[model samples]
Target: MPQATFQVDQEIYREKISTAIIRHNYPFMFVEHEGIRDLHSFLNPTVKPITRNTAKSDVLKLYKRERDKLKHVIESIPSRICLTSDLWSSIATDGYLALTAHYVDENWILQKKILSFHHMPPPHSGPILVEKRHLSLTDTLFCGGEFFHVRCGAHILNLIVQAGLKVIDEAVNKIRESVKYVRVSEGRKIKFAECIAQLSLSCSKKVCQDVPTRWNYTYLMIDGALMYRRAFDQLQLIDVHFKTCPSDDEWVKVENIAKFLKPFYDITTLFSGFHYPTANLYFHGVWKIQMLIKEEIRNSCDAISSMAKQMKEKFDKYWECYSVVLSFAIILDPRYKLQFVEFCFKKLYPATYVDRVKFIRDKLYMLFEEYMCLSSISTSNQSSVACASGGDNIGDEMDEFDIYESQHYGLTRNKSQLDLFLEEQKFDRKQDLDILTYWKANKLRYLELALMARDILSIPITTVASESAFSIGSQILNKYRSSIVPKNAEALLCTRDWLYEKGNIKFSNEDEEDEELAEDFESIITTLKNSSNDSHSSFS
Candidate 1:
């Protein structure tokens, strides 16, 4: 095709190209490829295809623009933000912390933003990590972070499951060995398949090995091996070398353990979701996990009983006494108010159920008072206050909806909103309730307690959001792109997320970039390496 005289805006087109490179996680030099350059030239004879340096500059510019835009959105938010953190190491022996923020905006929609991909050196201890972030963002944290340090539900479940899995170690080893043997050679695989065919085994599953560290994969390995037991038994009779097949008794033990792990696997998948699962939604998942552990603790099988005890210790260490924040999250759910809270605690700690429930109730009331004080100052200008008392709008749309004064809302001035919330009958649990929508629709009703719900609901159930941010690490920090400066690298990763927020990029696992570390920030801060304090880089 002949070249055409295309009068394209040079800088504008360069930015579009730069956005594509970062959004798709392409290397800056991708634009420098001969084919890319030639294609641009053919399409626009007046076009100036960017060199690698130009691509880098354009990416940084885009990053700064988006960072400022997100910063303003964050600063203007009326409710507190929840955060999740992840620390990562690069091939260059560099450390980066990825910070992500989850919050309900003024419009009452849940939002997640990557605030920073900061560079930090080694010695990433608990205190050091805390201090590094507080150096700049301590003020933005909720209530001085007394309720911060929310553990990832999925990670704790993994730990508990791994501890319990110790009882099945012997059975798992035998299955692992048999799978390795079958997979070691093509001949062995074919022989195993023949054994399945000849034995007329109904199982469609092929035996596979697990990574050992991951309990879910281990569950799959054992689950599949148990199904193909007939084939393994047949192989043992036919092949002299297939001596590692699990015994019938061992298979029976494996089956019991798989049953024990099935609920945990389900919960992990639930909590690890990127978009949907919230802290409020996790009460049932965690309650079911606690019950399952208690159920197995009394099992007739010694191995299963012993495994449950081991897991109980881990669970007690992390969850039994440490789920105050999570409990608060569940209490905020309109479907399960104080009654469900009492029910959950009564089931777990029967003897002290009353006291435990009292403790949570008192703490919630105290937290609500703090929010009440904060809201008094922030709500002075709220036009909703005018509309509630049958007054005119203060330069905004207003409505006289006095539910509090009406008997329908059970309005009482002596009782606080938290008390009133507890007294009201729980919303129908069977009904579909978008909790955010519920709170937003009733914002004029409960007022400050509704603000607390905004933050509590935004609390992440898992670190999966931050972890998913690293899914693109393999594509970004490869040998070819490893030399990209830390400043540019942070810019690229931050912009991909910023682009996703703007509807310019799809936030799919198939394409993304990995930055250094994790954790959410109050603002969209893509902090640069402390060593290179470039002024134009706004988030730093």
Candidate 2:
């Protein structure tokens, strides 16, 4: 007998190597790592470690395999999907565009996928972005027509609040500068810590720096600094160099501004949720924002009123273009539907309430009719098959009559799906009531109407999902890893998300070990500090 030779499994080997590259955001040259080569050598003496070029090829192959799997999933699904896209500039001054798709699968689970994350060369104008998207999505199974483009609601809220923030820029600058002054050096940090200890303040949270691009960071910085007000006061008394301490009136203004901005912050956070449907929740938030603006505009304080005026201008500028799709989305929610929309819109736009309500109702009906036509064609084809099979031709004819009656009466006499859904008692369960669950349960009952709901409900209220992809891109393509070609970076970023979604990846035990080490180090430092204090007391 010939001696049997042991052969390495190329597929498994390639998978293990690809996993390393994705999990750690490793460079393609990672195969050249001494430990990696040695481990491969130990596993298979006959197999050679892959070179950088070969590793890159394997990574691309893995990416294509994963991309094909996702494409199959998107194609297999029968519902429309919503897309959110955003442009980001990397540390290397490279501009990249990210597109994410949102949908509710048949299991009633909310699903988000990063459809594309790739470089968008210079002159990133609107038309250029649109053209880039058309190209990127061309090969994917998803049809562009089925997708509705939604601007990120959180980003829009940021813009609105930033407009209001401009009203108190000088005050915010002072607070920010004061925070930077305290955090700039170790001596200042020590001095500030001493002041906190002396004041006996319960807060252990340190002052934080604010990034100008994110208004919420400013909120957090001011909120944190306000907690150490007395400490700062103490610092001002002893430190001659503490020139940036906010004055009493400035502190008061900061407090008022924070208070005024709290609702916007809360709404932004609420809308940024990834695990649930936000479309149905948008109307209530927008209504609350409108009410808040009105209330603030009539405030007794001149400063707040002026700020509200600026915010209101920005809010109207964007929201006036609020797509009818948003209204349709809310109407599909059984809990709200057309009645709730009418009531809210009447209160919101009292002057043009009649016209707006009529417009929404008409648009919703038109949408329903469109879906009904599609359902009719599908039902007719199935019925024709049943008739040909000789199961029950008479029954099939009767079923057609029922569908015709439903459509004719439902449309001409206000007995349609919209009316039926609206007239039925609204779903009373509010807490943890899954909107997708309700739709799934009632899909058969409403038939074509349910199909329409699924498509519209899948539409996200914001582009935050795409913005989050940019965040991941930033981490993957940081300054230290600037040499990562855009193609590899895209593969790494998207694969990471796909693997996470599929539950094929998890945080390593090393993270837990590091956390434990940190805790142990902190405890040791505390012990040393107590020992030093005790020694000083004994000496005294």
Candidate 3:
């Protein structure tokens, strides 16, 4: 065949090559047959010139389109949503915001979706406002859904520590000293780290002195330090700041710190025992202050009228109890105590000062009077009603592995013990909605929607909704493609998967209606069973 080959025209050869290339899905273009490697080298020699986008520009366009597609898909989702947000600061101090949306499905089942997760420019002023703005954008983009401030559960540990410090000044001081010691001296830190490493079976030197919000990371460092306390003490002797005898007033500081931290230990214990437990919701820490508020109200209710009459007599008492006055002052002023407790309390109780005072007095008095009667009752005399009564008992359900299992504070709750708590505490689930109404009235509906949203989204606060675009963006906007003018990330995120079928994402508005449907379905199934049973009996 080669010997018989005749000289073929270049045009004919190119034509044959083009046909073959089209039919065979070959990579090469016909222009390469003659070794012509022009800018149009990718196309066949016969292929006409057409206005075309560069690979980088094409990808940038697609990326932008995909983002819009996703945003559309999310916005079309009809329901209330809750968000979990966390700020990430990389080693470069680059700020990244991770926000997740949670919602419920049409069947009223919980769903979570990563709504947005990516870096936002660091806020120059108030970071919270930036967070608020981001949240507002999510709501605006996704529609008028509510947002429940589910601040990271891990943050509660620090709060618990703060609360624990209030009652246990010595322990708080010791912890503060420990924190300060590590921070103040490189020598002390090295010694402490060495000591802790020796004592801990699983200690990491790298974890020392990390921020508290890093949570488990910070805990690891402290746990290690505690494990090797003897070695740590040898490495660095803790000087006695006071010259007082070790057995006398010095011990009281230790006692006070312990007292402050006792409630925190209780919270820790409860969390450690949870089944679906998240560490450090700080519920108990918050509850302690709530209880304290109740206590103060009870103590202060000598009636303003009666107090005026006894004002002169109480002068000595005032001097003795100046700490109480200072505590009250701190509580009233938002500037003191890091602004957390007061801020949270105000948010929880959303009423004005006068209104809050009146509310606390009325609500606490009613709860106290009711609880007093129940507290006086014997376990044998108690009923399930007793277990489900008090508002305070509502918080008890937060204990891990308790209700689901047979445990209370990690121990088996014998029927007697269960009955005792049930009688004494009387926690009713239905009443929860009512109780929350007092605190959550301004925000209950909104919060409920947020809970529903979180349920339906089927994702966690850690979900990466927006970051999904980041890799694609980077791929298109590489150094080689930096000339590409890409669309904004938000627009891209908004419209991804817009036309796709999203099954049952819109949750049913009426929970009662769904319940009714379920009941009807069960009834139909029961009727069918009954009919079949009758037929079987007749045959028999």
Scored by lDDT, the top model is: 1
- For model 2, how does the per-residue alpha-carbon lDDT over 1-540 read when each residue is reduced to its tens digit? 333268877777777888888867787787888998877777677656788888788878888889999999999887877777778899998999998888777786667899889898888777654444554466442233323345567777888888888888888888787787876776776677667766777554446677677787778777877887887889999999888889998889888888988888888778875454447778777778877987899888777888899889988988754567777777777777777777877877889888888887887777777778777887998878877777677888888988898777765444777678878887763756677778899888888887777877777887766776766676788888887888988988888888764421123442453343221212333455687899999999
Off by over 4 Å in 2: 1-10, 39-47, 130-148, 204-206, 274-277, 384-414, 480-483, 501-540
The lDDT per prediction is: 0.76, 0.75, 0.36
C-alpha TM-score for every candidate: 0.82, 0.84, 0.33
Query: Which pairs clash (backbone N, Cα, C closer than 3 Å) in model 2?
Result: 152-463, 153-462
The clash count of every prediction, one per candidate, is 16, 2, 51
lDDT order of candidates, best first? 1, 2, 3
Ranking by TM-score: 2, 1, 3
Error of 1 at 387 (Å): 17
Quote model 2's TM-score.
0.84
Provide the lowest-lDDT 10-residue window in model 2: 516-525
Span of 10 residues, lowest total lDDT, candidate 1: 514-523
